[model samples]
Target: MRRLRCPYCGAVFEVPKGAVYAVCPYCGTTVVAKTGEEATRQYYYPPRLDDGEAFLLAVSRARMLPGAPADIAETASLARSELHYLPLYICSAEAWVEGCEGAREEREETWLATSRLPLPGLEHGYRFPVVGREPYDPRRARRGVFHQPDASPEPRCSALRARVEYRAAGEARLAGCRGSVESRAGLVGVAHYPVWLIEYHHPLAGQPLRAVVDAVDANLLYLEYPIPLERRALVLGGAALVLGTGLAAAAAVGLAAGSLAASILGGLVGSAVAASPLLATGLSRTGRYRYRPPRVERLFIKG
Candidate 1:
């Protein structure tokens, strides 16, 4: 047993010799008796939306997007929702890359590539414009009732992120140089980002559409779009009608010229021209779906 003296009250107490940290029993003062690398603190931003509000927000978003079925927000029921803290690699380092000219190393260019980590299958594909955010200490996270995601990034994911970081550094260094460049990463650490996962079923889409929302500001980051049955049917019918017309015209022309092969070729061309409408529609829909503005871009439904 070792006697520990309270710095605040000067009260002496006995604690296990192996204990690294303990609280003073008399004055409720914290004491640290160990030395080494300090542990990194995890944090979680308080979510504005609870279970109910999150569901409503998702529905409202659904209603605004074009091509979304009318009353989908109201009619579509939420099947499942998840709130989790996604880990990110917050790197603060500089790369010393070698800038080469022709076949020789020209000079050393120190390039700062990027710090934000990637959350694949999530917003911006990679973390973009990840600035200005306040986080609460995870140890005191019980200030509000919110779910914490238990899933963590595996070791392989860390390796992938490191590769991305190095590649980005190399590309940046090369871009600044004329011929070639070499890059290496430095300081990096693990961080956490909070997100809301909402899964709901709508009539238009046979499967559920998953929407990933930013828990802090309630912004929709990534949404899986689905095409309705009616649209699919229309696209198919329209394409078939045009193709059939093209084939018939080609066949007729070929028969008149006494060449069976010519007729087949003409039919193919006719079908393509007929299907132009479908192509145009598809392109238009694709452009709209990629629109990122929450207010301006009404809907982003993808089939």
Candidate 2:
């Protein structure tokens, strides 16, 4: 038997052994405890950190960026309003590669290259745990410390599984030489990973950009790019018109000069013109606002 807490109404009750689903007594919500082959993993919230301490730590982490917003202090202050442990699923897998050697032989002043390579096979698998939805509530009590929510356990786990599989396949392709190899795979139990959810309100863009930072590993999982509407329109639109005109001119010049030379120049110019907007959009996401976790003590206090 397991004790389950209702996310909607905050009711707690024991789920009987062999029972796969339970109806919430307070809210009448049907909560599924298991799905097919996946079993639900339990999670416990970490003890809240002191307000001053959390704020200092967040600020320190915020400083690692080269061009973080100037009012990061105020943004960090707003974080104090809510805090809760967020759940996440984590996994790691090993990858191996093997292959053959190629050699060259010279005889009678003639060079000959002999290459014999065996096809390589890669074997890897990922395990994931289902995390129930209770811990995802943004309004959960923080026990007086700043608590930033972590990734939803289900989605994060799903994404991690996909990443592990995709990376294994990609690594195999990159290693041209091939042979059979084996690797270890591991999965982490349900746990609340620390994160700093930074919401940025920029002057140029209407909506704020959200960024997630891993608390323990200090890795950036999700980051939104800030798009400057006016700048994008001007730069992109102007570049397109200019590049188009240049291509037209080159085509005309090629017809007058030589068809072959003009065609080569136009093709090069056209390819560059086509690739410019993508490069510009990539560059525009540089300036973003930063948010960090708040102190636990301050969150529970009434304003």
The TM-score values for the models, in the order shown, are 0.42, 0.33
Candidate 2, 101-170: lDDT as tens digits: 2211111110000011110110111111232223322244233222212223344334444555444444
Model 1 local distance difference test score? 0.49
Which pairs of residues have clashing backbones in candidate 2?
86-150, 99-178, 144-296, 144-297, 145-295, 145-296, 146-294, 146-295, 146-296, 198-291
Q: Which candidate achieves the best lDDT against the true structure?
A: 1
Instruction: Give the lDDT of residue 89 in candidate 1.
Output: 33
| lDDT (Cα, 0-100) at 16 in candidate 2 | 59
For candidate 1, write residues 191-245 as lDDT tens digits: 3455667787766556676766666667666554444556546666777777887
Q: Rate the local accuracy (lDDT) of all candidates.
A: 0.49, 0.41
Candidate 2 TM-score, C-alpha based:
0.33
